[model samples]
Target: MARFYCDACKEEFEHSSPSKKEYTDSFFGCCWQYVAPCPQCGKECTEKKEPQKKKRTSSSGGGCSSGCCGSCSCCG
Candidate 1:
């Protein structure tokens, strides 16, 4: 398991299956490319790095604002 800092919640979280790791693993899996969103914010950041400390001043704390997983083709 790995720890991912959620900017939405401003806290770190650990999980058995982080989307970042899953995205990386996908390269060796059935898919040649990989992409996923954050579990807390659904952000499209896939790099395995600590999330920047950003004070969330809004109530829409979950998911992303880029309007991904739909018109965006990052999942491909």
Candidate 2:
């Protein structure tokens, strides 16, 4: 997790730095987008990367945080 200051809105926000895979995927996708909430502006901004196919689309462009298992998980 990392924090960034948005000069446009003059706000500070805590953002999770995209992983290598996320960066790569976003870079390859049409728009490498990262979601981060601006503290001062209270606005959500998309951090664009190189742009690749959007990664983690199964549950709406995010990873499994509910502890649910996917096909890849044999335990599931």
Candidate 3:
């Protein structure tokens, strides 16, 4: 699944269903782009790829705990 901003519907939508496609963006001079319908309004819209999400992690990221139990998984 990928996220897109739909200009036709003036909203952000996810394009995961069938009929999603990519084509060279003539407006941008040959950059390939994602084309899909607005999930809410169903109007055809163009969308740039959403930025990759940052992974959620503990501040220490599995390093030694800074709490009561050093070996406890729950300890930060």
Candidate 4:
């Protein structure tokens, strides 16, 4: 499932279709457009992208304890 935001409805909705094409075709019967209609209000909707998570950085100086050694499996 995917999250979508509708400008007309001013709300967020969930879509079961995995891709935009599938979502559009299932709801609007077309796949050429980039935006999909909101299932609640039948208005143009855009897919909501989830924020990417940032990797935690070590504050300690570089060494085996920093998880950069071969035993840590961080530096293959």
User: RMSD in angstroms, all models?
Assistant: 17.8, 14.3, 8.8, 9.4
Return the clash pairs for model 2, or none. 27-50, 27-51, 28-51, 28-52, 29-51, 29-52, 29-53, 32-49
TM-score of 3: 0.40
Query: Candidate 3: where are CA atoms >4 Å away?
Result: 18-31, 50-76
Better of 2 and 3 by TM-score: 3
Candidate 2: where are CA atoms >4 Å away?
A: 16-29, 46-76
What TM-score would each prediction reach against the true structure?
A: 0.29, 0.30, 0.40, 0.46
Residue lDDT tens for model 4, 12-69: 8887753434334666674653356787778767787779999987645555556553
**lDDT of each residue in 1-76, candidate 2, tens digit only:** 6555566786555677632323345456543445666756756655443447755534432335554444335434
lDDT of 1 by residue, 11-60 (tens): 55555654423323544754332234566777643334655899845334
lDDT, candidates in the order shown: 0.49, 0.53, 0.63, 0.67
Q: Using TM-score, give the best candidate's number.
A: 4
**Model 1: clashing residue pairs?**
41-63
Model 3 over residues 1-76: C-alpha lDDT tens digits?
A: 6666767666877778535454576576545455777768877776656479999655554555453334566644
